[model samples]
Target chain A: MARPASMRRSRRVGEALIERSMLGCALLSVVTTAAILAILVRQTGEFFAEVPISAFLFDTQWTPLFADKHFGIWPLLAGTFLTSAIAIAVALPFGLLAAIYLGEFATPRIRGVLKPTLELLAGVPTIVYGYFALVTLTPVLQKFMPELSGFNALAPGIVMGVMIIPMITSLGEDAISAVPGSVREGAYALGAGKLATVFRVVLPTALSGIAAAVVLAVSRAVGETMIVAIAAGQQPRLTLNPQVPVETMTAYIVQVGMGDTPTGTLEYRTIFVVGATLFAITFAANLLSQRWARRFRER
Target chain B: MQTTVDSDACLSPPYRTMEPAQMSNPGVAAKLSVQELSAWHGEKQVLVRVSLDLPEHEISAVIGPSGCGKSTLIRCLNRMHELVPGATHRGSIQLDGEDIYASGVDPVLIRRRVGMVFQKPNPFPTMSIRDNVLAGLRLTGMRPGDLDAVVESALQQAALWSEVKDRLREPGTSLSGGQQQRLCIARALAVEPEVLLLDEPCSALDPIATTRIEDLLGTLRERYTIVIVTHNMQQAARVSQQTAFLLQGELVEFTETDALFTKPKDKRTEDYVTGKFG
Candidate 1:
């Protein structure tokens, strides 16, 4: 069959367009990842070269406000861990129980309604959650404890915990569901009741996936910037106390970015330093989850 | 040995005693007395008022064309069908005398008594040959110490010991098709059940492997009550002592294997037996 002249031209155009779009998208992804990594390494490397690695790692006091430079990493690390500890403490039980209730106990109709409702939290902007935390949760906690600051690790961590509920629940549900049906049947056939099967057979089998889920969530808490920046008062005290004000790495980066610090100055380099730290935590988490997921699949 | 005119009433065992029968011929006085057995899936009935006894201690094969409730009937023996969601069965599937469906009777206990080898040889893929032989015992929560002695013996009983003894720690799935089936049988036998139900055991293997399983079945009948369901008529003739012809969810005929093949009373069974039609 002979092709019509106009149809052949259109077909050639369509082929070319598709080929360009595919190659263009592939190039775009590679360039974006490589560019981000290169920028982070170059800027952060300069900051490290200027500051002694020992002083930056061990110094407890962070005096960016003073004339003399005193860069302490502990205060920032302490603040990050404190908020993460609080966030995880709040999120773990609530998220796990919610997942169990939703995945094992809920009717399909209930899950249909609840799953989308939970997923809606993920779509909500972190800035909006920060505002909600600063305005609402801070006031509520302050009323109970008069000594508690309005903007502190406590409120932001709690809000971040609430923000993470959807992620933890969804991931937990998927991990729980991925357990083979035959194992469940085998348990049932052995006279194990529904609760027994879940606790004993299903839970042990899904341990690796659950661990990966928790690691991913921990990294999420560590990397969260906006809520803490707005709600957690910018006093990077190296304390375990949740009631006290603390400046997380993410919050510190945002604080420096909002200022009139010159482009090539040490203060500008601080943002990239925090970014590199955040990237490390997230990268380690990704690697851990990948290993855990593969191990679980091999089982 | 004696032949009676009304053979439908009772087929006398050649040995007539359990003592003489354990090895030579386990007196096929085996009788099944299923009463008012009604099975359901949620509200939908699958086996409606199913009431029939299986011949005991003999290779009683259940044969039917596709979807004739053959698998359902076999699963009911080991209380396997009840594991499905919304599945329920009413009435009793009695053994020599005891009712298998009573409330006080544990379904697990019943399944332990009536061991089943599934349509598929589902040897635990992760478990080794030694572990596979002790699968039922493991699930039954039996002590590990006691199982060690029985595991080897059970494997030997299933005719897999010679082939697998050197590599008992090797995964069950690492075995050949015939070996896997035997491993499954060993797993079932480890529990020492009274009746062993083979649900189309040979359908998955090649002809040579199928023949080996059949030959194993013939030898196994001396120790346990064997009931197998096979699509291959040659397989049924080769292994089973009795044959029950089923069609469209109903039992058409149940008789001696030789008689079923030679002179089937029912037209349907005769047709099925004579290679005319299924």
Candidate 2:
């Protein structure tokens, strides 16, 4: 009943070919990631050979494109953190509340309609969000605060917060739903109402997943280009004020990337250094979040 | 002489009711009285018109085959059955003469008065052992004056205090399966519930753990009116003073455990007890 020798050899060859093709697909992503890291490191190294590392880290101004060049990364760093902080402040409460409502309290019929509608916010193009911040949100805010700038960090920060709400809501809901029903039953048997059970038992159990979601969303906000560039003006200043113009690391990269600066010049190379710094921050945040999630699971 | 006869008739009813309360130990008042209770999950009926009286400060066991709706019966006791989507029930369950399912009665309060321990151990994985013990009180928003004393008393009652006292801050899931089940028991007891319901609590445990919990339940019977649903006939005989035998969602017999095991009146009960058919 065994197959012929020729047929057996052909099947083995076909299986080996399939295995090799799958291996190739798997290695493709690794190769692409390594390549990106290599280019960033190489260019960043070349940029640093010309500009002093201390000046890049400590100097106050970041006007490399202007006549007076100061390449301190502090201004960009400050602007990035300020906007990200504001975004997290807005997103944390709204996203978490929405997730809790969807996961714990909402009826299945309501969740069916509401969850898709919420996620549609993520599908809207980033350029549309940027324009909305610049034209609609900024003018409305200026009506209240007459001194508000035409292009300011507040509008973009708020818009970015709205843009990332779906990410947090989706992830948080999954985490909350993953908690076993028995735990909730135990809580209910103890006379805990819906809200009490959510806050006391469900929230704490889902904390690790929620933390990972927030970190990933923050990473997305840090790398976001259009909203910040269109609304947060290219005025790199080391200030925490949101009413005035600011330039984030991402926004500066967009500015220099589109400009007519010579590719070999120091001004042009500044983007790679800033990009590396941003990458490092986000990479660390992602690593920390993953570790936290793993530790919670192990426990 | 006629008036004295009427008064005697009125007084004799109490003594008459006490006669059938227990064959061996009479006069123990009923803590929970379920009368003509029927339940359904979605469209499928689970429990038929069932009537039983659980004695106060004693252990009662419900024994049935799988899918015979014994779990549903106990869940109906504290109104936990209605929590499931599309689950419905008729008739009334009275806890100390108060109908738990009456209009304007909150199921939440009923559950607090009648706490439950499930078959599988489910300690809040996020909370510490100390916190798990106090979860019933803290989650219900009552901050007791001395949290440590409550934890100590609850753990002691569950017979888990000596093993877990040194590591109160450890997560509740860090313990072994039996200890975690005991923690769940402690969690249920910490709220000082009047009635404690257990649904096949030792189905997932080893014999040694089962023996420990049975011994613990023997001690718990002095304070809490307890009802346990068990599939094992020996477990029901060993741990319960009163035993109710159920088949196909119908109550066949309820009497003293010794009588139910040794001399079941109903033929089906005899078959089940004698292992002729489950």
Candidate 3:
């Protein structure tokens, strides 16, 4: 027999309420993202109105807070790229090797314990990493290279690399594990050793996913703030020398965002412009990674 | 396990202490011999003391109902069974006259001599058609003298060269299921293995594809010793010269395909062949 009308009506009301609440939760993220984008765009527009686009884009130095006031974003861009490059150089090989070991060589018991322990690195606060880079890593590096600065790009870049290892490892391991057993069996049947099978079949098959992971890690590196702000000094110099100090876009924003600059000034507006540039770079990287991941699935 | 002692007796220099009933054919020499082979996954035994002689340069078929250890038997032939976690085997298998499972014998080298095709088509998805055919040599780091010639010959042997010749640069996964299976066959052939083990290779194919593969296998039998595990009785009869029927992990009947189908020696074999029960 059908349920009573009153009970059915009450059940329908409950279902509608749950559906509406779920939709509201879904909409919340979209609304927050749109608001962030709007703020970045509007403030960036105001900043650019005062500072010429050419000066912001092609200038060689960034000194918005100084009396000399050169607003070139190139130094910040260079510093950001240099640190991220260092991070990728450190993290890529280590992360990929760890992923291969965890996915291919390690037994289930070992992987179960190791993967979460490695991921625990991701759980540590960023500010703690910042202090570690400044206090622990910088002094260690200084012992080897006597000329190394107390606050330089190398220390923070290395720390950032260590911080993002779990991101690459977790995602890369998932990609490697997703390769079918039949493909691996085919390789083994052809007399391929574990190394050959891993390198020839598994790695190539998981290349797209691994690449996406690396790109995501690069994006994370590019957007990282605390470690760079603490260890990479506020010297906005357009140089690739890791031994010297450099300032990143995020680091510059952190410098300004600490309530030092007056409200509604050109220095304050620089924060939005730099933030916009960072958003654009990271957004492009994320888009490229997503596209690559989708292509891998389609194939 | 009486067959274990008989196989041990045959292992000596005499090599002729075989029971007349155990042989598939009197004249043909065995290429690979399974002597009282048994296998287990963890603690659950999948194959019970089974013995068979796969004649050189001929097709042998293992037929059984689901989970009757037909696939396990063929996997044992190539040492592929031991790859599974907690999977173990007892007894011995010999290739030519060498014990494949002897201490210090590398399973990797054994595998190169005995290649396998699986139930599903598993061409490496990232590789080009030509690369898939050459994957065996390339993956094993065995440099071929003439890459183009090797690719052509292997694909030709698998009967896939003509269809895929123009699209060698295309990804292997781009081909149809049958073409992909043939591609995998070409890959297995590229290594120039002495024996080929196929586990239900045509189970996932259509009748036309199945017919194509059967015809291809007929040609392949002249060059390589083949063991195929099939669930379809007609397929076993159509493609194999020798047929072995398995039930509940035991080898019930093994003889000439014609004799086994027409006049099964065991009652269980007779019942299975007559479609009485699995």
Candidate 4:
């Protein structure tokens, strides 16, 4: 069974070349991440030289464009948190229920038809959702409440929640489906009804995957740009009221990026500072999700 | 009742309806009976006109080679067969003289009365050992005032209490394969079923674990009518009081375990038991 010496040598050399190419592909991603970290830290240091960290973090106002500027980040942070919280509140219950229905109860014919249609929602561009929020949803809200502003957080937040619904539903369905059939049969043999099995056994078993899905959806909502920029106004008011207009972290970056601020100015550099803050928040969210998911992971 | 002339005409009314007095001369009550039962997986028929009577509070074993429909027969006892897609069945399965498949009977109630343990150990991975035992009660919404006593006694019945009592709060998956299987048994016993069905329960266990589970079954037989499916001929001889041999979904022979092993009335049964052919 021994191979010839020359053929074996050539095969060994080919394997080494393929192994090195794969290693290079893997290092590319690591190097990209390191480069992004370096650039953000360098620009963030430059931003802090002119503006103190305390003022940037603790100040209530975010009026970097005004003649007398107040460089606080609270208003934008508040807007980001508020919109994301609202989106989660809307998405979690409906998305999870849909997933349970699809995974546990749907007939094969219905599931074949419904699953792809639900996933098609994820394929639609966010810009279309932004247009829908501004033109259609805003009017509907104003009719219900006369105090509703033309460009308000409520419309954009609701639209953003709609956009992420398919993400949670698809991922949650996969998690539920991954539960072992033996465990489910055990539940059934113990006289558990359909609802009991779904709620107690299947949902709990899939909790880690569902938690991972929710965290990923929250990260998506936090970094969403077009929906907030178009539907939610450019005003960065530190108000909890959904009826009023507010600007999010992503919206502010887009706002500054489209403006005529000169290169190297503090006003121009504000985008990177805001970008770093958003990146930190999303990174923390991702870490928290992985930790949460690991706790309930199936052995 | 007279035996019918054409054996394939097994589903006729008189043949299907056997009087309780006509069974064995020892006269034990029949807890469950399957008469002229036939099953199909989709369009393919897998079982044909199989019939047997299971005595109360005793272990009866069904032995057969692979693809012989042993598991399917047990599934039909608890109406688990109907859960499969496109599966259909003919004939009646009676529990205490009531046809379980008759109009207006709920399969859920039948399952509660007849609990099953699968070949593989499947404890609820997300649940603590204590919570796994309480799952049946929690799911059925029949919580007793003193939950600790119920959990302790169920685990004690399954012979897993001493090894697990100190760490009942740990996840069920933390235990060894044998302990996990016993936990599953304890969970099934928590509901207090009238009949317990085990489908090759010891197939996944070591010899020691298998012996422990078999010993527990000896004790459990005093209270519950038990039916087991086993591929191991020695296991059937050791544990079952009566044995039913099946071949290609037909009931080839049904008799006392000793008689069937020592003096098989049919050549097919003799061939199977002696390892001549499946």
Candidate 5:
């Protein structure tokens, strides 16, 4: 066999091969995320020039409210935040407890059934759920609060909350499960009971991952469209009252898109502006989760 | 209850029969007696019928080759063996004049009185150093007023107080390998148990750290009964008054340290002592 001409040259060749493999995966991940961002920015920028970014982000009246220069975004922004908050409030206890049940308390047979069923919930189409919320859920909820309209923020928010339950439960369960069994055993060996072990030992260890899961689900909730469009009224009111009609940023985009508005016109351009803002908000949430997760990674 | 029978015949060694020390201080009492003990995990029996006695306030060393069930036997003392789904034991062991496995006795209480140190240093990761020491106290349900002294004494006993006193609130894992092991020892001692069972306490430590732990073990023998499981013949020879040699789950011999190391009674023990095989 022919030997290498020089040891130094051969070592450089080996190092280059290893470096290429290491950076290849990193490059792929960075490039993919960058491409998606670039596409959103390019398309959204074109939409913004016609509408004028100021009118789109900070106007008081959102109409098509008045037809000429009534470009308020507060209504949609408020609606999105309100719905997401409500969803978090509902999901925090229900989804987290469900995750706890599955991760800690459930027997194998029960866990086998529950996890996939939660997954099935995640797989259900938002449009179909939208129709269900508008027809079945709205009327049922209206009976409890007679003042509630046929299409209201509460119904859409509740549906959105239901939509995200699996996101919270599944990711939270994974975080809880990632806790090393030795940590749990240490607590158990100390004579701590199951609940004490879970709450005091397991939960603290898993908190960062769970927090990341919650932020990600909130991002998903903020970016939801079809269900909110179908069930939430397109009033674009800056109100926190759940029973009242409100329009989310996503819902308004769909409302504008579906109508006969001219494609490159100022009114039409507002949709992309809304889309860019939605994109920014979700990106911010994603970054926050990533930072929190990295900060808490085991040393 | 004790005698000096130059034990080269019973111990695995570089057997050095050191100058004689006083026999049976008579201060330490025999706390546990093991009889016809056998253990199995699933269908595979891991330990043969093994028997030995552990006296209070003295260190008893159990040594053997890997997989000889040294760890399983210690775990049996406090009922940790039952924690494994398929593990089962057949035998009788008495702690403090009471049968630990007898009906009506609580393993929880037995564990509190007979604490353990793991092979690797596992200080509870989530707790502060002070909190880690007090974990056993909290497990047994202690009021805050009662914890301060217990935590202080336990750390002092483990020889970790001087190193960690300034940073009591720091996580237990922030400590180095030897420090973590000593912290774990402090945690076990926090409950003020009568007996401490160490399963290879020094196995994960470096030579200097091993020497520190060995010194701590000798000092600790003045107050608490310690049953140590070790692979190091020098460590057992240096620290243990009574040494039991286990070969393939069987206790081949148990005798005074000097006698066992110098004049082994069994041929297998002699062979092991002479480094034919561990």
Candidate 6:
């Protein structure tokens, strides 16, 4: 029933080689992350030397291109926060409700037809979404409020929120469905109705995964460039009002990258400094999300 | 190839009268009665014309091989089988002479009266051990005024109070598998159901854990009518007052556990109990 001794020994050797190669392939992604960090840190060190960390962090105005330049980080940081907060506020409730509907309420026939159709929203290009926000959503909003700007954060934020709904909903649905079927049966057997079982048992159990999904969505919103660049306008100002124009860090990067600023210049190097800040914010969020997801897995 | 079973052949001496413990209280009636039950998963049939009577405050064990509808029969009693997509059934299951499947009767109400434990322990992972015991009451909208007492009593009844009392705040998943199953049992007991259905509760447990659960079941039968489905024939012989042997979705024998084990009437029942074949 067993393989011959020499043949088995050769098979074991072949398997060990395959395992080592597969492990090496897995390490490639880690190496890529390290390379990105190395490049960003080296450039960021050079920029901070000339800009002085105090002025970049404390100054209120960010008029780098004007005759008198002030390199304050708060204005861009505020812009990123305002747009991402708006996007998350709009997306989280709708995404969670859609996930619940898809996971618990829908019949198999309806879910089969609806889930894929909803996920298709994720397949649309971000540039197309940018175009839609700038041309279509802005005009539609201006109809109700005539004072609305041609380029504003609200339009782009709302469109970006819509773009993020599929990601949160799909991830949340996977989390909910992964709660063992026996858990649902236990609740049902305890005389809990569909709503009670879903809210009390299913939702609470999948909370960590849902929270992780929301964090990923927030990171996506923060890094979103095309939509903010095209629709949120080019003015970097310290404002929390979504109705006004503001430039995010990503939008600033896009602007400087498009303008073809000479390499090694302070203006060109500013992008990497801003990029380092963005990386820190997203990296912290990702760490928190991963921790929560890991705790969920311990169950 | 003998398919048909005789009702009289399966009837033992104990079937004519209640057991010695119930003889002093002869006024008690059958707690659950299933008549001509047939169930289907979409177009494929699973249970066919199965009928049995479970006496009040007693343990009844349903024993059969895999795919013999042992789980289906118990799931049908609490209407849990209906939760599966495309699962349908035609049966008259009466709880205290009231048909549970009648148009006016709600399954939620039926389930409240008849709580169930699954084959595997499924304590709410997000909840604490203390909260897990009170899950039924919280989920069912009948929040107890004496929350501490209710949790203590339920855990006590499930024989897990002493072990979990110190770590009541810990997550339910932190417990061992046997402890988790008892936590699930405590969760069911908190609802104060008239009957408890256990579907292969010990199948996932080790022998020591199985013995503990079996002992708990013996005590639980004093207050609540209990029905268990187990594949282990020895388990049925050890724990049940009445044993029902199901074969190919039909009730082949329903008699006292001792009588059925010692003198099985039907050829199929004898073959199965003797371990000659499934």
lDDT of the candidates, in the order given: 0.77, 0.88, 0.90, 0.88, 0.82, 0.88
Residue B125 Cα positional deviation in candidate 3, in Å, after optimal superposition: 1.0
Instruction: State the displacement of the C-alpha of residue B17, model 6, in Å, after optimal TM-score superposition.
Output: 28
| Model 5 CA lDDT for position A129 | 83
Better of 2 and 4 by TM-score: 4
Query: What lDDT score is found at residue B244 in candidate 4?
Result: 83
The residue ranges of model 2 lying beyond 4 angstroms of the native Cα positions read A1-14, A296-299, B1-27
Cα displacement (angstroms), candidate 5, residue A32, comes to 5.1
Output the worst ten-in-a-row residue range by lDDT, candidate 3 chain A.
A290-299
Off by over 4 Å in 1: A1-20, A60-66, A97-114, A120-155, A190-196, A295-299, B1-32, B42-44, B123-140, B161-181, B206-212, B273-278
TM-score of 3: 0.94
Tens digits of lDDT, candidate 6, A159-219: 8999999989998998888788988999999999999999999999999989998998999
TM-score of each: 0.81, 0.92, 0.94, 0.94, 0.86, 0.93
Q: What is the lDDT of residue B16 in candidate 4?
A: 32
| lDDT score, candidate 3, position B26 | 50
Residue lDDT tens for model 2, B1-278 = 00112112222321232222112233568899887788899999888777777889989999989999999999999888988999999878889999998999998999999999999999999999999999999999888999999999999999999999999999999999999999999999999999999999999999999999999999999999999999999999999988887776776667788888997766778889999987
Candidate 5 chain B, which ten residues in sequence have the lowest lDDT sum? Answer: B16-25
Report backbone clashes per prediction. Answer: 2, 0, 0, 0, 19, 0
Q: Write the per-residue lDDT of candidate 1 for residues A1-299, one digit (tens) a residue.
A: 59899999999999999999999999998898789889999998998899887878888887665698788888888899988888899999988888877877787789999988998988899999999888998888888988888778888898889889888899888888887775565444444456765776677667788778888888999999999999988987888888878999998888888888889988788888778878888888889998997887786
What is the per-residue lDDT of model 1 for residues B98-171, given as tens digits with 9 covering 90 to 100?
Answer: 77776688777877778777666667655688876766666666665766678888888888888988998998
Which candidate number would show the highest lDDT if scored against the true structure? 3
| Clashing residue pairs for model 6 | none
lDDT for each residue of candidate 5 in A1-299, tens digit (9 for 90 to 100): 36566977888899999999999988998999788778667767776665676876678767763546577788889999998888788888899999988988887789999999998999999998899889998899888899998878888788889999999999999888888877776666666667877888788888888999999999999999988888888889888898888999998988888888886676776777778789889989999998877865763
Q: Which lDDT value does model 3 have at B116?
A: 99
Candidate 6 residue spans exceeding 4 A from truth: A1-24, B1-6, B9-28
DockQ scores for all predicted structures: 0.20, 0.63, 0.74, 0.76, 0.37, 0.79
Which candidate, 2 or 4, has the higher DockQ? Answer: 4
